[model samples]
Target: MTASTDLLATFVARYPAQPATAFWRGIEIEQLARAFASDGVGLDLGCGDGILTDILFKRIGVTPRLIGVDIDPLETEAAAAYSFYDRIHTIPAQAIPEPDASIDYVISNSVLEHIPDLEGVIAEVGRLLKPGGRFYFTVPAPGFHRNLRGSILPGVSRERYLADLDKRLAHFHYLSAADWRAMSARHGLALDSATGYLDGKETRRWEHLSRMTGGLLHSLSFGKSRPIEIQRALRIRDLQNRMALPAPVASGIAKMIACPDAPDSDDIQSCLLVTGHRPRD
Candidate 1:
């Protein structure tokens, strides 16, 4: 393999499996299985690493003809071992490599945040799903928690971070539950459900610490001091993350912080679970 390809392969090989990643994999698989009956063809958009694809195959046992699509060739290469995908398509988020109305179910998880043209992607997802087919996905909710470093520094002055945040959030456009509902309506889809995933307070605490440390490191030039320093920082981050609270507990704390004013029934902040359906003729 070429040097660049070999480097990517090594990175993929060393990528550790984390609890949070496993939780989302389970969520996506369960959502897809619940949405479709046996023998249904499904499309996994932005199927990075194919973890969710494998989960769907093992849990559902339907052997649903699966098509995995991603923009990253390296991720697709790493996903080759899953063997659940009947085919893999490398395509941009705004355009899918599938015939119109060809898929019975469409699923995306934590992928929408990275796409610049979300509306175009939504339109493409709509075009790809057959009538009555469902789309299940998640997106970060709009709040301080949705800010670039919101999960890293809760106590920093908003003004201090706003400029830096603007640059980061530029790559991500989080929507409120209402915003998603309206977006779905505009695209001839009905919002079936919306649920939050983090408490507000917890999100703020995580963001506060993360941002403070990150800012200090940036200002001290630690991030660029040397290749060794960069590697050291990465190691520390991995250790800190591993030592963090369990997913359920972290999620609970995030909801409390993010939804302080929220009603009892709606108390999540960071992630939102959304399901929608295309209108039938």
Candidate 2:
């Protein structure tokens, strides 16, 4: 095998999956490890289950003083298992458990899209970041719906498909570059950089496969929570972290993965990553 193929195979093997869905997203993030490097303290917002962040850092080979914050007690306990973060806090988005001007960097991965009050999160991110501190996040564009049209729901009405997705994913907004600039400006943050990833065709493939696998999981679990999701037990959580496999599924008109390796070429891409900073006056 050529060097690139060998690398890809190694990547795919290292980040194995049980449901085998969204495997591409992990590969995509690992490719952008350099951009995620941090110098001082760092925080992860909405750190669901924390497996992805753990896996990503392992790939990047950097273990900075990272703190994880999530609202779900289940997720916060799970976050401790990977031992990826130096500290993990369970709190609301409005209440980050950190002092002002203390954090050097913050990352919100695949999280901003699901929030109902986009402005509040932006405002709080501004509050937590130190001057010149950066926040890197990923959100899908408005055109994401196009991928869902024939891929996830064929013979279904547009209205129905959209409603189903919004309900299933609990999503509120999808933003373009213009939206990012406006929101960042309103929240006292400046756009440092941005890039998009996952083309329409590739996004459709990811979405289609995700739904199929999720359905299989739901049926297999029989609507009961899996024990490996042991929020009350740390030892079991750390040992069986593999249960966090398959990665969380995503549904939208557009799908985007966060990868700094991708070039900023297309506006109509599946996912966009925006790096914002608090500029000193």
Task: State every prediction's TM-score relative to the real structure.
Answer: 0.64, 0.76
Candidate 2 Cα errors over 4 Å, as ranges: 1-21, 31-34, 151-155, 215-267
> What does each candidate score in C-alpha RMSD?
9.6, 6.9
lDDT of 2 by residue, 1-281 (tens): 01123223333333333222344444346434646656688888888777667656766777767788888887787678765578888887877767888888888877888788778888888988899898888777776776553424458777776665565556688888888998999988999766766665556555655565543344355634332332224354344445422222321111232222333344466667778799886
lDDT on C-alpha atoms for all candidate structures: 0.59, 0.63
* Model 1 Cα shift for residue 180 (angstroms): 1.5
The candidate scoring highest on TM-score is 2
Give me the overall lDDT of model 1. Answer: 0.59
Query: How many pairs of residues collide in model 2?
Result: 6
lDDT for residue 109 in candidate 2, whole number 0-100: 78
- For candidate 1, write residues 226-281 as lDDT tens digits: 32244245674344323444545545433432223332233445567788788898
lDDT of 2 at 52: 64
